[model samples]
Target chain A: MSHHYIKTENLEYSYYGGAKAIDDISFLITHGEKVALVGANGAGKSTLLMLLNALKFAQKGTIDIGNTFVTEKTAKFIRQKVGFIFQNSDNQLFMPTVSDEIAFGPINMGLPKEEVERRTDMALQRVGCESLKNNITSHLSGGQKRSIAIASVLAMEPEILLMDEPSSNLDPFSRRLLINQIKSFTHTCVIATHDLEMVWELCPRSIAISNGKIVFDGLSKELFYNQELLNECHLEQPYLAKIEQMKEAEKIRSAN
Target chain B: MENLDRVISEIRGIETDAIDRGSRYRINPASRIIVCFLFLLSMLTFSVFNIIDTIPYAIIVILLTLLVNIPLSYIFRKTKYLLLFVFFIAAFNPLLDRRPAININGFIISYGWLSFFTIILRGYISVTAAMILILSSGFIPLCRGMEKLKIPKLLVTQLLFVYRYIIVLLEELAQIINSVKARGYGKNKFPVKLWSVFIAQLLIKTYSRAEMINYSMIARGYDGDIKTFSENKWQRSDTVFCIVSILIIGFLRFFRPFVFINNMF
Candidate 1:
């Protein structure tokens, strides 16, 4: 069976006469592969994810998700196959309550009421947010809101997940909770994030984007040692890696 | 800033309390709608000088408020600004008409005064009834009630989104205002010249936020239709509540029972 679940060839997008947001980007993800997208501010990581979900149409080139080309006609199908979690949980969670947020996607898909409720309950349970089932979305804390946002998209049961900055502004506990949840997902995942710690822990492969172009794509461990490449991409090694280097320097000093 | 915080707290209080199952107002949203509509309709049907007719309606409002465990003082506080508006609109009634309409004891009551009093009564009843509905039914149930009443689904969805986004807009505005304050902007009396520029920026941010919301919705399978889970069940008590309310309102509107009772003494 083919492993290339998503393939974009020479994809290009410009934002409303502004400079190119995405330029000649091409990549492929195997089935069930977890990849991290790292970049500095103003990089095209978010734009690329949006293009994959067909939230914004590319100005040039093709996007094929699960063998279906993304177009206006096929956008709905493409969206069904690719669930997107936005950077700001507030932006994604507009429903009144946690249960409503979870059921929103399933209900919009025209599922039966019972099925929608079942999926909503299941999703809430999966994220350990079942206690917030009836809580108003606005009253929820930052962590609860993020969990509910993920639950909302997960209720759609998409094959591929495109997450934008999934761990930004979360408390340490919630951040660890999110990492654990991401670790448990078996679906094909592409996460765009500034949190190199999350990238190191969750993704085996890494893709670095800079100025709307791919700067590097390879094994996650290999990318950590490439200081020049990391500096070019405006990223740093994971915190744990930095701690290890500090410990290694102390040992060298002690031995000398 | 205290005023803004107070307003936000009031809204949050309403949102949380409206859905309490222990509250008497937590009846079927559809039944609440029917009663609210009938109450408004019956109150509006009274003659211009039928101030006595609203006595029963006022009693109903008081009873409902007490039964629902909502603070009467809170309702009055919230509606005071609206009462000011209603007062202004009816202020001209007494000046516009001077013809004598009735004699109370030795004094003659002018037709304008009678009508002015009636208008004030009407405004009070209508506004209080609307507030009761809102406080009792909450926003989500009210939308569900509208949906069950055969209102256009699009309009219902718009109402829900508007209610949800208004708080977000307010919060976003608060953030901008805080940033401006940190940067040495105006305090109480803002500069009038900057109003247009500030509003324009707000509009742009609102537009972009709306686009992001729409994109998120679409990604989750929104096909121009928003669907929500409504567990509102219509019980037998809802039917009984609807029937009893209609009959009482019908009596008070048509028979003028308070007037008869007043004459009996």
Candidate 2:
């Protein structure tokens, strides 16, 4: 089992007394693969991401992360291996201060005091938030909170990163910074997002889901070009892809 | 809606005061808790008729409030709402016990009135002391201090959650109220018919938000135990402060300082 490898088979989940959120989802993400899980709202993108990390257990299916199978017993171990960044940074950060927020995961993992301090500092620096170490988590701006949320999970040193709508509610600059940060990570990342431009840039492969089922699983370019699939999944083509299309059309017109 | 906003901001302000390092009072959290507990206990020991005797406790609370650099007005503002409830509870005391206790210049003061005054005084002192403790040492440190004092982890965790989530809850509530007002349902007062529906909606939203927060907590490898990055060490100043506070509290509990002062005057 290669580290950072994630595979889910026939995954299914349903909210209590509610409709199924995920149905028969199957995908294999190899080590260091950057994959985008895109779908319409109320689709299973978030649930699928949760299942990958075992934050939400599947009603019926199997999830394999590296060598460990995700079950109730292995959920703790799975969390250590997979770091989840929630869509709402507020929900992700609960600590009083930034340093405490970052150190929380490491400390909870029972790391030694020195190691916890080292990891907390390193994570703060990683997120370029060293100056915010003492700032209150709730008092921080939206971008700062999001960065700290990422740092908080990064402190645990997980092999796989699962982010849900990482770009939501962020300004342009913050979104670009986040994109660059995610781009630099070597760990396998599965981002569930509606940001098509982000998917075009960061993810080589994109998986589109509609009505709790996988509609398309292929390269991002192919998914973007399939207008019917994009419409069905409630996705817009990336602006960059549109630019490329216009450029191609311009060249053909000149040749004619 | 404005009141809710003020409440939230006031809570945040107190939280800021607790975590501020520039404040002169930096007593260890555990020592502050101990001193506060002793102060409250001493205040509680006074009988209802011993209103004058409770004066020393009130004075101590005022002095401590000044020492902690918290403004008197700020304390008054934070505790005024609570004091109103205390007033209601103490209002019955004067009505229930009408026996004459003190006579000054032939004007009679009933034991009930004295008890009422004493209850209000006690309420003010108790609340002021608690405010001082929290303002001196922030919420997280206070929880840590409580844990050090052998308080159960479950209770400490609950306290911390309530403190943290109160802000979130208030924000959620503010949004609901704003939306309601935007829809022009109630400009002066909330519509009575919408109360049940609004409350049910808030409850459902709160439950779902709680579920999300719980998931976030578990995703971060949270076991049953809550841990902190900063471990507070007991210091010499803490020990000295604790000893002096306890002695003062004990002296106030035993000696009637207000009566002595009155006699001298």
* Residue lDDT tens for model 2, B46-131: 77788878888888788877777889998898789999999999999888999989899999999999999998988998888888
DockQ-derived CAPRI band for the predicted complex in model 1: medium
Query: Could you give the TM-score of chain B for each candidate, in order?
Result: 0.89, 0.88
For candidate 1, give fnat to 2 decimals: 0.90
State, as a TM-score between 0 and 1, how close model 1 is to the true structure: 0.93
Each model's TM-score? 0.93, 0.94
Roughly what TM-score does model 2 have, to 2 decimal places? 0.94
Clashes of 1: 0
Cα lDDT of candidate 2 equals 0.87
Q: What class would a CAPRI assessor give candidate 2's docking?
A: medium
DockQ, per-model, please? 0.75, 0.73
RMSD of each: 2.7, 2.2
lDDT (Cα, tens digit) per residue for candidate 1, span B114-140 = 888888777877887888788877877
In candidate 1, what are the lDDT values of residues A103-220, reduced to their tens digit? 9888888899999888888889889998899898878999989999999988888899999999999999999999999999988999999999888889989999999988888987
Model 1 error, position B9 (Å): 4.0
